[model samples]
Target: MTSTRTRLTPEQRRGQLLDLGVRLLATRPLDELSIDVLAEEAGISRGLLYHYFGNKHAFHEAVVRHAADDLIAQTAPPASGPPLERLLTSVTAYVDYVIANREGYLSLVRAAAGGNDRLREIYEEARAVLTDRVFREDPEGHILLDTPAARLLVRGWSALTEELVLTWADDPAGVTREELLDLIAGSLPAVAALAR
Candidate 1:
């Protein structure tokens, strides 16, 4: 049978492949998302995949970077709203993002912890962006984060939120989504206040 696949521009094809990688990542670790599998799914030869990404590691990095960017974009705070309301909005989006991308998020965390310097850097950069958002959106956060100790406390709070959200995603433990959001969003000031 003659192939009837539509031709895509180089950039379009590369983007299409990356999108597929991101979707597949939703269920498997980056390490297990082999080039062969991606090629088969894309209906392209492995050589063509390498032609686009140069190598497996490069492809993995591209997929991870896309995922991180998507997560950050999805969780961005509203440009204008009541401070507390904005925080809760972002937190709600974040919780929803992680729950929907649970396996992908977990795999990203595992990749960072697996001693890959580049992946770790990508993960840390995403965390830093999120931490900075908390400070930027919280009306009192600027004053609270004036000192080095205060900033550290906020970062710690970010970690706490991450752990709680991940745990809650796995098992709610009788906590309602609203309760979890309120707990995470409401605890920031108290956590940041420890620096005072």
Candidate 2:
């Protein structure tokens, strides 16, 4: 079997691996993203897969980090305003990014939820930042009960965002961005009052 030890340019190899990993998630569940299949598809042998990622879980962790960086980079809001304003900007930015990376993000979601506890832990940690931002923006908002609550809510929102975006991914006509944002925004009042 082909491995990903050094099949292409390093960046290309990495891209190929990540592409394989993320795309595999769509056809199969995250836990089902076999390293053998991944190596085969990427034109690398299983050994290279190991050489590149150490193992499937390590590869997954790398994917998670890459995806999170993309998210954090894409959604980082203006830092000179109320937390809520910053949050709104960040969320909208995030929605746009999610719309852009639905497949990859959803893949990670499935993998994180259906695979390792470590994966789940990492996802929750990233998710908590969003909750913290939300709470900071609109203190005592409806969300923010605990880390789990934040993960659940953020994941819920992400799932919704993915589903809606996926449905509209190729279509020209669908829920406008404003409408989607409004739906998310509408829940703010309750979230703001969550712990009250």
Candidate 3:
């Protein structure tokens, strides 16, 4: 096996393209995206775009991976504490991320639901990472006894949170972000108490 040297600073170029793709994700749905459109936006040719990613599916996969990796890194479980508190910290970080990067992340979620199969697969992997973290932070929560139970819990909680976030994004005036976080965190204690 021979290791080929990158000819045109491929690392930097790939970063630029991913960044470009992420921006496009926010503005336009992923299904409608084309390598030509991405190339025009980045002021690069389709050949150059192909060099970085073989197709739109590959490009979107990279974008989801990049975003998910960053989110996972940033929202890592808190150091040493009541699992509940650590869980809350992780959750708060999630809400904050949604508030700050609403368009980009939500688009990734939407794309995963019904976009390129490659990208959808990558996005599901990312979602699992996040859902797993939620479970980790709540090890003693009701879902611990079974994997399917845990998945169900995650789905319910995440759907509610997602709706709350969409509402927040739509009208920041009506609901306080802090209040939402409190309500979510409160559920943990309630659930944990019953489990005990």
Candidate 4:
């Protein structure tokens, strides 16, 4: 049997490579991904992967960036709603995303904690974007709401949420999803208290 590969535009080709990288990263650690294997899977040569990304590190960064952007977009709440309602919606979406993308989530977390500085930066960037989105349109518009202390509190809460998701991913049966959502949602008051 014979197979044929379709020609793709530069942008389409790059996206295809990144999508493949994300899929592979989900099931395997970054270091385990290889140009040869990825190329073979994509029906291209190893040299072609480098042609698109320049090198492995660049490819990894691109994949990480794409994942971060996607996660942010996927979890963003509706533009208008009660703060608490919006928070719950966003948090639930986050939990669902983490559960659905366990390997991808774990790979990113492991990379960040395992001393991969670029991955860590990407992780931090994602957290910041989440924080900004959550606070960007607070209806209250109180002077203290967007203060530096408040911003830090949001960042800290986001870190805590990450840990919670990681733990929940390890043992879904240990805590019901409702309980997981409540735990993260319940922490908002404490976060607010700190900001005040």
Give the Cα lDDT of each candidate. Answer: 0.86, 0.65, 0.71, 0.82
lDDT of 3 by residue, 1-196 (tens): 9999966577987987887776676566556568888888989799988888887668767777777776777778766677667777887888877766667777677766774676677776766777676555444543333366556666566667667766777787766778878877776555433433
Give a tens-digit lDDT track for model 2, residues 43-79. 7689988888887778877767667655767777676
Off by over 4 Å in 1: 1-7, 137-143
Off by over 4 Å in 4: 1-6, 141-144
TM-score, predicted candidate 3 vs. hidden true structure: 0.74
Candidate with the larger lDDT of 3 and 4: 4
Q: Give the per-residue lDDT of model 1 (tens digit) for 1-196.
A: 8989888899998888988998988888788898999999988899999999999999999999889999999999888777777788888999999888888898888988888899989999998898777567454535354567877887788889989999998899999999999999889878866777
**Cα error, candidate 1, residue 79 (Å):** 0.2
**Between candidates 1 and 3, the TM-score winner:** 1
Better of 2 and 3 by TM-score: 3
Candidate structures ordered by lDDT, highest first: 1, 4, 3, 2
Q: Which runs in model 3 stand beyond 4 Å of their true positions?
A: 1-8, 31-37, 137-148, 191-196
Question: Best candidate per TM-score, number?
Answer: 1
What does the lDDT come to for candidate 2? 0.65
**Model 2, stretches more than 4 Å misplaced?**
1-49, 137-174
